[model samples]
Target: MKLRMKSLAVVMGLLVLPGCQNMEAVSPWIDVGNQVVKNAGYDTDSKLARGIKETLYTSTDRASTGLSQVGAFNLSLPSAARPVADGLRQFGLGSYVDQLQDAMNRGAEQAVAEAAPVFKQAITGMTVNDALGIVRGSDTAATDYFRRQTEAALRLRYQPIVEENLRKTGFYEQYKGLLAAYEKLPVAGKPELDLERYVIDQSMAKLFTRIGEEETLIRKDPVARGSLLIGQVFGGAEG
Candidate 1:
């Protein structure tokens, strides 16, 4: 009876061992398991949402800063306007072309810097279904989600800034000058372009591209996961 009692006491002590003993190493999974139902993928919806939001926050910040630099949006003239641009280049009026391209890039760079708040708002407002789809879907799922949710708003926000910056940079006058020179040449087609819309569209596309790259990095590179919650949620860290 004494031996049995002693063994029972040892088992009880082991059972009551504090959960905090290796908490730094164990807490992430513990928190996950408490709320998760252990699906094949094994993540709580809330944790998944939090992890994705964190990832987007990091992605947006990095992309915005990187894309806001000089020459960051080194976009070419629109394809529709290519003939016009080529004609100007042939006529030795290339300075107008250079000035116009530079102005578009400058406007895009300035407008992209304002995108973080819009991205954050979209991340904050994602639905449970949206989070789940992002976690289980393609590599660019989060980027796609951002596009769907915030593209219109981002375009609306970006247009005025881009227009203002373009005006400040004399893009309109340079573009008109380029067109006038191109019209004087024997360019085959009268190339039409919505210059401001083109700039906004190109900038948004590049911004999404950067964001997609970040999402791919976060999913593939453990170092890019950036937090215990993200690692456990996305990287399958079992407790």
Candidate 2:
């Protein structure tokens, strides 16, 4: 899976791209790459799935730090809601919240890990001609295409796992406790949160977002491809 970095580095300089962040501006190269992808012997779908899975690993690591770890959820809420939440969390309510969240995160991590094979298999319709569609379409087109094609299947596959994890985490009980505590305060308003749905939806959204970014990077950045198959498909275009 080692890509030709030195060659790619030389091409990157010749392409006049500023940095990895700037690759989106050179999407026209997608047109060039697409032609190569079609004629290249490797499967673009497999490469894409692997890249996305790798991206998911990196993304979920970051997300775990921000969303699944201790006090992670507390920092992300709106300012108006923070003071009351902070006061309660200062007492021991936050421990339950963090525990529930950590459970959800662990579940999501498992689901995402399980999803790599599914993602690869989901692209069953990925013909050689599809490369052109990916090139002509927007940055998120691959993600959009994949989701549009397999969203229903993905949900069916992921929901049960999410629900099971939530149960294991005691999310429902914690949510009820949190809501009751909120309702007890004379000044506290009802927070109407669907905890189960929130975890499921948020996990799916983050997974997809990471996948889309991986798709974009594979199409745009030489270094990000990280595979001989990827480089062969995309390298000859700019080489």
lDDT of each: 0.71, 0.53
lDDT score for candidate 2 against the true structure: 0.53
Q: Write the per-residue lDDT of candidate 1 for residues 1-239, one digit (tens) a residue.
A: 67655543343233222322333444454444434343333335666687778878877788889999997877888888788789999999888788778878898998999898898889889887777666655667788888899998999889988777667655577666776786688767666576788899899999999988987777665334556555554554332
Q: Which candidate number has the best lDDT?
A: 1
Tell me how far the alpha carbon of residue 82 in candidate 2 is from the true structure, in angstroms, after superposition.
Answer: 6.9
TM per prediction: 0.72, 0.55
Q: Point out where model 2 deviates above 4 Å.
A: 1-91, 170-192, 223-229, 232-239
- By summed lDDT, the worst window of 10 consecutive residues in model 1 runs over 12-21
Q: Which TM-score value belongs to model 1? A: 0.72
Instruction: Report the C-alpha lDDT of model 2 over 133-216, residue by residue, as the tens digit.
Output: 543456566677766765667567667776676677555676567767866777756554545555566667776776677666
Clashing pairs in model 2, backbone N/Cα/C closer than 3 A: none
